[model samples]
Target: MKIWVLRHGQAAAQAATDAERPLTAAGQQEVRLMASLLQGQPLDAILASPYLRAQQTAALVCTELGYERGVATAPWLTPDDDPCEVLRYLAERQERNLLLVSHQPLVSQLLSMLCEGHRGAHVPMPTAALACVDTDFVAAGLGSLVLHRTPADLSA
Candidate 1:
């Protein structure tokens, strides 16, 4: 299985609620750029944090790729949520390729957990960044980093 993890795009700083925070104009454009980069891939599924920012980013990517949104909301992808459960869930999924759109610390933590098998080691996943991992879904913690890209890299 191949998993693509993406951090949510930049969002407004002061929103009425954290869950209500939406992406900025620049963030939307950055997401478009990221979507374009992923256009030709055969993504089997998209799992996202329930936060508005992450949901919007996933929606944009699905629209650009012409794939009906097969998005699943996982609480583990939410900010500060435990990522081990998310990893476990992904390991059981039947999809060969999955995309996950989420927030900072959680996204960062999840990548580190997937790559290193533990957390606390920082893997900075900047806004609109993506990390691709190839692994055997049946065997947990067996994966290799295939690619990592940030919006700036895409722009360049």
Candidate 2:
């Protein structure tokens, strides 16, 4: 199975609440460029945080990929959520390929847990950064980081 993890694009500096933060214009552009990378890839479902920025990012990806299935909002994808919970949930999913649009800390920690089998390793996930893990099953240490790219990398 291939799991694609994407951190939401850059957001406005301030908002009424953290979850209310919206993507800036630059964020939308970044998301669009990042989404192009997955144009021909098989993505069974898109799961994203309920945060406005994440939702916007997911929408841009859908527009780029022409993905018909709407994004599913997952509360567990919040920035502070536990990576273990995410791992456990993914293990039971039937999809062969999945895209997760979420925030930082959770994104980085999840990648570390998946790639290193533990949470200590730091995988850099800037805004709109993306990592692709190929795993036989969804478990810590069982996956390989086949691809990791950021907006700067893409632009370059």
Candidate 3:
């Protein structure tokens, strides 16, 4: 299975609530750039946090992919949710490719947990960054990090 973890674009600092935060103008543009990197791929499903920023990010990617089904919102993808449940969920899914749009700390923790067997590797995830993993399945320390790209990296 190939899993892609994408951090939501940079959001406005002020919002009614953290979950309600929307992406800033720069954030929207950066996400579009990142989306371009995955265009033309047969990506199967997109699972994202219910937060507005993440929802917006997923929408942009889906647009770029020409996907019309809308994104599946998963509670486990929330900023503070545990990664184990998500790993279990992915292991049970039949799709070969999955994209997860989420927030920090959880996103950063997921990167280390997926790449390293443990959560020690501090993978720096700037907003709109993406990391691709090649794994037989989703589990603690069971996947291999194949790619990590930021919008600037793609632009340059």
Q: Judged by TM-score, which candidate is best?
A: 2
Q: Candidate 1, overall lDDT?
A: 0.83
lDDT of 1 by residue, 17-77 (tens): 9998999998888888888767777898898899999999998888878888568887678
Per residue, candidate 3 scores C-alpha lDDT tens digits across 68-142 of: 878999988998887777677778988888899998888888878887867668998999999988898788898
At residue 99, candidate 2 shows an lDDT of: 97
| Per-residue lDDT value at 123 in model 3 | 90
Model 1 clashing residue pairs (backbone): none
With a 3 Å backbone cut-off (N, CA, C), the pairs that clash in candidate 3 are 117-141
Worst window of 10 by summed lDDT in candidate 3: 81-90
> RMSDs, each prediction?
1.5, 0.6, 1.0
- Worst 10-residue lDDT window for candidate 2 reads 33-42
Global lDDT of model 3: 0.89
Tens digits of per-residue lDDT, candidate 2, 1-156, equal: 999999999999999999999999999999999998898998999999999999999999999989999999988999999999999999999999999999989999999999899989989999999999999989999999999999999899
lDDT of 1 at 117: 79
Report lDDT (Cα) of residue 54, candidate 3. 98
